[model samples]
Target: MKTFQTVRGKLSGQILLWVLLAMSTTVYGQQSPITISGTITESGSGMPVAGASVFIENTSFGAVSDFDGNYSLNAQLENKDYTLIASYLGFTTQRITISITGDDLEKDIVLAEDLLSLDEVVVTGTGTGANRRSLGNAVASVKSKDLTNNGATQVDQAIAGKVSGALVQQNSGDPAGGISIRLRGASTISGSSDPLYIVDGIIISNSSNELIDLGGNSQNRLADLNPNDIDKIEIIKGAAAAAIYGSRASNGVVQIFTKKGKSGEPKFTFMTNVRLNELRKKIDYNTVPLAWEVATDRNNLATVEVERYDLQDAIFDTGFGLENYFSVNGGNEKTSYFLSASHLDNEGIVQNTDFKRYGFKANLTQKAFDWLDITGGFNYVRSISNDVPNGGINSAYGAITGFLFSDNSIDPTPDESGVYPVTSPLVARTNPMEAVDRFDFNQKTNRVITSIA
Candidate 1:
C-alpha cells in the first residue's frame, strides 16, 4: 500500500511539470522578435541608392538605408505575413510580401527610374495618351542638350540646320530682327507666313510680321527670347502631327520648353561674355573731291552759300557689347524652384545708337498631392533703345539712300545759329550728329504664366 501511493504522487507531479513547460513555451513564442534586412539598387545601373526608406506597410517599424543601400529592422513577431515598402525620390516604389520566421531575413530589390518610364508614354491625336511604339505619324523630339550645344541667340536659329524638312532664313543681319521659317513651302500667300510658336503649353503671339509694321519692315519676335534660357524645342511639320493644336497650328508649330529644377542640392552658376563689333565693309571716298572743290564746281548752279560737312564720318562709331547671367536651382522631393537674372547691353555701329535690356525669370513646381501637380513661371523684361531715323529715299540714314562716301572738306560742326551748315547736296545732305540727338525711343515688357496638372 505504501509503494502504490508513492508511484501515483510522482506521476502526478511529472504531468504538472509538463503542463507548466507547455504554457511557458506558448508565451515565449508570442514574444520572440523578427529581423529583416535588405539592399536597394537602381534597375538599370545597379547602383545602390542610399537614404531610401524601408518600412512595414501599416506599422511604425522602419529603417533608413545606409551608404551601401542596406537597411535593417526588428519586429516583435514571427511566422506572419507583412507588406514591405521601399521608396526613393525620382524612382518608382517597390513592394514585396514577406513572411517572417524566427531567423533573420534578407532581400535585394531594384527600383526603376520614373522619368524614363513616363517618357515612353505617347499621346494620341485626340488628346488621349498612347505609347510611342503604337503611333503611326512621323514625330520627332529635340532634347535640351541639343538646343544648348551651339551658342545661338534665338531658339529659331538653333533649330535652323539641326532639323530636317524645315527652312529657316535670316532676311537681314539686323540685331533683334526677325527670322523667316517656312515648313514644306508656302501654304498661304497673303496671310501670316511664319509658323506659330507655342511655349510651355501656352500659345504665345509671335510678332515677326508685325514687328516690321505688318510686313513694312521689323525685327523677328523669336530674337526677343534668349536661347540660353530655353530647355528644348519641338517642331510639328505635318498636318497630322499638328491636328491637336486646332486652327492656329495650320502653318506648323514650334514648341519651346524652359529649364526647371531637379532633385539635387542647390547649385549656382555664373556666365559672362564680351564682344567687339566693327564695320563688316568699309566705304571708299577716294573718288570724291573735297567739299570746297565740290562747292566751287557747283558755284554756277548754287544761289545759297554752301558750307562743308563730314556727314559720313559722323554717323559711325566703334561698337561693343556685354552680357551677364546668374542662376540658382534646387529642390526637395515635393517641390523644386529655379531663379535667374540676366543683363544685355549692345552698342550699335551707328554713333549714339544702342539697345539695353534686363530680364528676370522664375519657375516653381510642387507636387501638391499624390495625383495633383502644379507649376508656375514668370518673365519680366525692361528695354531702352536709341535708333537713327530711317525714312524715305532722302532719309538721313536709310541704308539704300545714305552716301557711303563723302567729301573730306565738309565739317560736321554746327554754325552760330545752332543749325548745321549746309554743303553740296551730293557731298553732305544732313548732319549725322543732329539726327542722333533727335531720335530716341524706349520700351518695356512684362509676362506672367502659370499651369496646373
Candidate 2:
C-alpha cells in the first residue's frame, strides 16, 4: 500500500512539473520576435528606393526592400536597444536604434544621397587616384549618367560641344569620316595634331589609320570604343594637368575609363532607340523664267521646251537608324561581373550609303584579399561602312555639285537596261547620277581588345 501511494504521489508531482514547464515555454515563446515594417525613401524627394538592404545590427536577421520600398523584419530580443542599418549603392547608409517592447512597430526611414560623388578621382603619376582638390590645373570630368542623357554613339562624339576650349569636327558626313579633337589650339605646324588618348592607364592611339578606301575618308580608331561601355571621361586642357605625359601630350590629353562590376544581386537591363534624319531643304537654280535650248534639239526651237524637275527628290531618300543594347550585372562580396552586347544600323542621307556595327564587352573583378585585387576586361567589335563618290571640282564624277551644270530639259532617268541616260554619250560630262551607281567605296573590319590587372 505504501509503494502504491508513493507511485501516485510521484506521478502527481511529475504532472505538476510538466504543467509548469509548459506554461514557462508558452511565455518565453511570446516574449519577443516583434514585427517591424516600414518604407525606405530618399530624404528630400520622399521617393521609394528599392533594393536597399535593411538588416539588424550584429545579427543575420534582415530583409530587402521590395519594388515599392516596403520592408518587414521579425527580430527577437529583450526590452533593450537594438540598432537597425539600411544601405544602398551610391547613397549614404542610415542607422536607427530603438527599444523593443515585444510589440509590432512601424518606422519609416529617409536616406540622403552622398554628396562626395561629385568629386571624381583622377589617375596620378603613381598609378593611384588623386583627389580633385590636390590637382593644380583644372580638369573637366564627365560621368556615365551624362553620356546616357546625350546621344553619343561614338566615344569622340560623346564630348562634342560639351567640353570647353575644345574643337571636335567631323571631317565629312561619310560614316567613316574621322573626328578631330584639338585642345589649347594649334600645338604644332604639321605633325599629327591629335591629343594623346589614354584608356585605363594604358596609352592608346586615336589616329585615323586607313586600311581601305571609303571615298578616301579615314576612320578614327577611337570610334571602335562603344560609348555605352564607358564609365567616365576626363579632359586635361591645361598644361599642368598633362605635364606627367610629356611631349606626347603636347596637344593635351583625353582619358577614358570603362565601367566596372559592382557587388550586389543580379540586375538585367534592355534598351532600344530609333533615329530618323530628313533633309529639310536643298539648293537649286531657278528655271531662268525663259526657255533654254540644248544642243540636241536646237533646230526645232518651238517643239523643244524646258521642263522643270526636282533633282534632289530623285537622288536622296529618308534616312533612318536603329539601335539595341542589353546588359547583365551582378556579384557577391568576393567576385563581380558585367556583360553587355549592342548593335547599330545607320543610314545616310544619300541613297545606297549606310553603316552597321556590332559590339560585345565583358569585365570581371575579384577580391582575393584586403590588399590583393584582380580585374580583367575583354571587348570585340565589327563595323561596315559604304560610301559613294563625293567632294571636289570634277563635274562628271562629283556626287554633290556635279549636277549643277546639267540642262533642265535633260531627263536624268535610267532606261530599261538599268542604265542612266545622259544628254549625250559623246559629251565631256556624263550624268552625275550615273557616277553614283558606277563608283563603289565600302570597308569592313573586325577587331578585339583585352586587358588585365
Q: Largest TM-score belongs to which candidate?
A: 2
Tell me how many residue pairs clash in candidate 2.
Answer: 0
lDDT of candidate 2 over 149-171, digit per residue (tens) = 67666888888877888899877
How many clashing residue pairs appear in each of the predictions shown?
12, 0
Local error of candidate 2 at residue 257 (angstroms): 1.3
The TM-score measured for candidate 1 stands at: 0.60
Q: 71-110 in candidate 1: lDDT tens per residue?
A: 8989776577877888887676766677776777897766
Candidate 2 differs from the real structure by a C-alpha RMSD in angstroms, to one decimal, of 14.9
Candidate 2: lDDT over CA atoms?
0.74
**Candidate 1 off by > 4 Å:** 1-151, 171-174, 208-217, 283-316, 389-437
- lDDT for every model? 0.64, 0.74
